[model samples]
Target: EDSIVPAAMYEPLVKAFGDAKNQVSLFKDIVLKLPRDNRATLLLMIDFIILVATNQGNQMDMSGMVTALSSCLLRPPRHLQERISAASNVFAIIMFFATNRGTFFAPEVSSLTQFLPPDDPALHQPYSNDKAEQPQQTQQTLQTLQTQQTQQPQQPQQSQPK
Candidate 1:
């Protein structure tokens, strides 16, 4: 439990996707460098997400899970411009990882390369509900959130008890 997932762990992979000709290999190289426990923790979380998404596909598919979980699992770098620039790549990597399921990391097993996103980093965009099963419902929920945030008055803070 590190509260902040290290940007060092993610940014290199993001850069690798953009710069490396063999992005999968470069991604594996970056990942295998992590400490054994860190690697296990990362993979285990991804696996759990995969399992939940698989059983709940009607409600939340793999792409949805990746969209929701990536921010919780990896923190991007500190620079404002770089952070904005890297966001799509970060989403791409998470999508790639969830789709491939760490297949590149295991030499013994055959890689399941299905559902792989495009290698071109420029094509990666933040997940939109247009891709979701219920786009209208999701849009309504999002609109409701925006409306509440704008229309609701802030609660007054109470003094702390002695």
Candidate 2:
């Protein structure tokens, strides 16, 4: 039952963003309100940013992309940054999308790199290491959290000592 909720939430999001729209601000508003713990919401926000950055048509407004990317970069949750850093595929996709359209803001890209700790162990690891490892790490972490969520039954709270 718990597993189904995530899949369910993602399906509609993918459908809604199937096409790019100028209503980027509205999308940003909705994303801001979504629960921080939900991976689907974060993915949806990423997808939305990608879509805006890649849109070839005039309907694709870069302003929205800039706004969304700025918001995400300002103080992204650790999990979301981990997800982005892990997904090399997302970078390729974003580049491909941006190339045909125009170009993504360089500052935004640079800002994202700051998401990682300056001395992250991954930075010291060999560059030849599998690029796919980060995504797998993210998935494993998310799964562990989800499993914990499902297994831990809620307990009624006792009044605390004043």
- Winner by TM-score: 1
Candidate 1 per-residue lDDT, tens place, 1-162, comes to: 451235566556656777757787777777667654455556666776677788943588887777787767666666633753435755677677777864644534212221223583423544333556577788899999999999989989999999
Q: What's the lDDT for candidate 2?
A: 0.43
Off by over 4 Å in 2: 1-37, 59-67, 72-162
Q: What is the C-alpha RMSD of each candidate to the true structure, in Å?
A: 19.4, 21.7
CA error at residue 151 for candidate 2, angstroms: 52
Candidate 1 lDDT for residue 47: 73
Clashing pairs in 2: none
- Model 2: per-residue Cα lDDT over 25-83, one tens digit each: 43343333444333233344454666665678746465455444543323323444443
Which window of ten consecutive residues has the lowest lDDT sum in model 2? Answer: 1-10
TM-score of 1: 0.55
